[model samples]
Target: MNIQNIEPKYEILLDTICKTYETGKIKAFNAVNTELVQTYWEIGKYIVEFEQNGAKKAEYGKALLEQLSRDLSIKYGKGFSRSNLFQIRAFYTKFPKIQTVSGKLSWSHIVELIKVSDDTEREFYEKQAVIENWSVRELKRQKDSGLFLRLGVGKDKKEVLTLAKSGQIIDKPKDILKNPYIFEFLKIPEPYHIAETQLESLLCDNLQSFLLELGRGFTFVGRQYKITLNNIHYKVDLVFYHRILRCFVLIDLKINEVRHQDIGQMNMYLGYFANEENIEGDNPPIGIILSKEKDELLVEYATYGMNSQLFVQQYQFYLPNKDELREEIESVLRGDNEIII
Candidate 1:
C-alpha cells in the first residue's frame, strides 16, 4: 500500500536479478572459453593427424596453415586466421593432454603460456598464474621479468628443475627469500641515488609490483612500523604477513652495502617481533635487511650461528641482464654454500 516502501523492495529485487544475471553470464563465458580451447585443441589434433597420414603429408607443407585458415574462415566467419591456427597447433604441442588444461584459464592466458619452451618452466608459470590469480597482463609481466630464471639462479640444477615443475614451496623462512630483489617497476633510472625513505615511499606507491616481486602469500601490514624498548624507539621500513609461512616479515632498507650492524639491528627487530608481536598461533617473525650490496664474507660470518631469523639480501633498482644473473647464481652454487637469503 505504501509506494515508497514498496519502491525500496523493488530496487532490492532488481539488484538481485541483475547480479544473478551477471553471474550467469560470467559462468557462461567461462564455459564457452573452456569449450573453445578444447575445440582448438581438437582441430589441432585433426590437422596433425591429417599431416601424418600418407596422402596428406606433403600437402600440409608451407601452405598448410594458409589453406586451413582460409577454408575455416569461409565456413565459420572469423577467429581462424593463420596465426591463430599456428597458436592452436603450438597449444596442442605444448599441452597434448586435455586434463592438463585449466578451465579457469582462458585461451588468452594459454596463448602466453605456449611461448615458454621448457615444460617445467611453463608448468611453474601456469601454476603461479592460477594460484596468484594473475591477469593476462600480470602473466606477461612475470614472464618478461624472468621470474623463473630469477628463482633458479641460486638453486642447483636439480632444485631449479623441481622449482619449475612445482611452484615455490614455503617450508622455511629461507625458501621464500630472493637475493637482489628486482624493483625496475619503480621506474628508477640506473646510476641514480635515492634515500631510504624515498625508496620505501616508492615501493609503497607501487605496492602491487612490490608484492609481485615479493612472491605469493604475502599481505602488506604496514610501513615504518614502530616499536619501543627501554624508552628507545625504532621503526621498521616495511612489514608484511606471509599467509603460508604464518609469520610476520620485517624489512629494513639501506641504500649502502649491508654491514654487521644491519644484521644486528634486524636481529633486534626479530627479537622484538617474536616477543611483542607474535601471538600464540603465530610463528616467529622473520627479518630482512635489504641493501644495495652485501659483503658475502661478512654476511656469512655475521649470520652464522645467529638464533634469530634474520636475512640480509641486496635489492636492485633496475633489471639486470638475465643471462648474467643466471650465470652469477650458477657460479655461487659451485661453491656449495647456502644461498644468500
Candidate 2:
C-alpha cells in the first residue's frame, strides 16, 4: 500500500513486460523479413520464366523490367522501382536455388549482396554477414573495404575457397592478422603528425568501430595496459581478449616501420602475459606489433625459431586503394611473390 515501496516492484513488472514484448516483436519482424525475401525471389523467378517464354520480353531485355516495374508499382503502391526490380532479378540469378538464400537476411541485405560480381567474394560476404549478423550498412562497408580480397590475397585458390567456406577461422595468432589493418574510421588526416598516444586515444574513443574492423569476438580490456617486470615499467598501447581464441591480445603501436627492438619487446610482452596474466584455461597471449610499415626480412630474422606468438603488421590511416588492392590480389594469385605480406 506504500507508494515508495511499490515503485521498485512496478518498475520490475514494466521491465519484464517490455522484454517480453521486444522478444515477440523480433520474432514477428524476422518472420516478415523472411516472407518478403521469399516473395521477391518468387517475383524474380516469374520474371525470368516470362523472359524465357515471351519473345517480346526476351528481345527487349531491360524493357521488360521497366514495364514490370511500372505495373507492379500500380498494384503494390511503392518499393517497385525499376532498379529494385532489376536487383530482385539479379538476386535470383545469382542464387538460382532458393534454398541457398538465407532466411536470416532481409531484402535490403540481399540488395547489397547481389551486387558483388565474384562468386567467391559474394559467398564470403554472405556467410560472414549471416554469421556476424552485419547490418546492410555494415555489409556494404565490408564489401567496399575489400575485406574478402584482403583475406584472399597471398593465397592459392584452394586457400581462398577454404576461407570463403570457413569465414575467418582464428585458430592461431597469425589467423587474426590483417596486413595494414584499416583505421580509416578514425578520420586521422594523412601526412599529419600524430603521436602513438593520440592514435591510441582515437582508437579507444572509437572502440566499437575499431572492434568491428578487428573482426569478431574481440572484447576490449584496456588501453595503455601495464605489465611490470622486476619493477621496470612497460605499457601495451591496447589490450583485448579474444573470446574465440581464449587469449589476451597485446598490441603495441609504432608511427614508423617496426624495428628489431619492437619485435623483441612484443616477445617479452607475450612471455609476461603468458606467465603472469594468464590463469588456468587461458591460452598463451598473442602480441601484435602494429606499425606503419615492417621490414619483412628483419622481422623474419628477429622471430626465427623463437616461439612467443609475436606478429608485426602495418596499419593505414586511410582506406587501402582499390586499384592497388586489386592489382596486388591478382599478382599474388598469378604466382607473383613481389608483395610479401
Candidate 3:
C-alpha cells in the first residue's frame, strides 16, 4: 500500500467516525431537552393539582415546593430548586392546556414565560417564541423589552386580548405591524448616527436577526433590486417575499427623518411591483419605508388616497429600554382613547 493513498483513506475514516459521533450527540441533546420539558410540564400539573386538592393553603404550597425540590434534587441530581418548582406551578396556572405549548419551546423557555402575569401577554410570547423558534435568551429579551405591550397598543381591549392569547392573526395588513420592533440583535450604540447604506448592509449581513426583527413570514430575496419603468431605472434598497402574505415586499431605506415624499416613493415602488413583477394570483406587493424617524401625520397623509399598500416604520439601531418602551406604548394607547373620546 502506498503511504500517500493510505493517508486519504485514514482521513476519510476519521471524518466519518467524527461525523457519526457528532450526529449521535445532537440526537441525544434533543432527546434530553424534550424529556426535560415534559418533566416540567408534569411538575406544573402536579403543583396545580396539589393546590387544588391536597394543600389548598398558601404556606403549605411553599413548604410543599421546598420538600419536593429537596426530594427531586436528591433523585434527579439537578434542576429542581424551590424557585423553579414555584415557576413550574405558575406555568401550569398560566397555561393549563399543554397542547397550546408547541414542542419547539423547551422548559427553559417556559420558565421565563411563567414570570409574565398577564395571560394574554404570556400566550403571545409563547406563540411567538414557538413560531419564531426563539432561543431562551431571545424569549427573555423580548419579554424584558416589552414586545407584547408595544404590539398590543392601538388595538381594542378585545383585539389586544385575542392577540395576547392566540398570537397575531395574519388576515389583515395591520397584523404585520409591530410597534417599537425589538432590535436587541443589532447591538448598536444609542443615539448613534447611521447611514442608510450602513443600515442596509448590517441588516443584510445579519439577515436572520433582521427577519426576527421584521416579525414573521419574511424571507430575504435580494438587495438593490433593479426595476425599470418608461426607460427610467430605479432601485429598491431591499426586497423580500412573505410566505404568509404571498406577496413581494419592497423595502426602501431612509437614514434621516421620514417625509411624505419618502412614503410616496415607496408607494410608487409598490405600484410598479404590483403591476409589473407580481405574478397572477399573487397578492399586491407591499412597500415598507424604514427610516430613523417617521411622522404619523405624514404617513397618514401620504398613504390616504393610494390604493397601494404602504407602511412607514421607524427603525432603531439598538433596543429601547423596557420601562420606557412600555410606558410609550401605554401612552399611545391612552392617546387613542382620548381621540375616541
202-315, model 1: which lDDT tens digit per residue? 999999999989988899999999999999999999999999999999999999988898888889889889998999889999888888988999999998899547888888
Question: 227-338, model 3: which lDDT tens digit per residue?
Answer: 8888999889999998899998888888888888777778888888888888977898888787777788877887898854788876666666667655644554456444
Write down the lDDT of every candidate, Cα atoms only.
Answer: 0.85, 0.84, 0.78
Q: Provide the lowest-lDDT 10-residue window in model 2.
A: 330-339
Flag clash pairs in model 1: none
The estimated TM-scores of all candidates read 0.89, 0.92, 0.79
- Tens-digit per-residue lDDT, 1-341, candidate 2: 77658686877787899999999999999999999999889988988888887776444768898888889899988999999888988988998998987788888899898988878778889899998999998898888778887777666756777888767777777777776688888887758589989989998899888998899889999988888888999998899999999999999999988888888888888888989999999999988888887889999999998764788888887778867776776665566764467
Off by over 4 Å in 3: 1-38, 45-64, 97-100, 321-341
Give the candidate number with the greatest TM-score: 2
Worst 10 residues of 1 by lDDT: 53-62
TM-score of 3: 0.79
Q: What is the lDDT, from 0 to 100, of the residue 154 in candidate 3?
A: 69
**In terms of TM-score, which candidate is stronger, 2 or 3?**
2
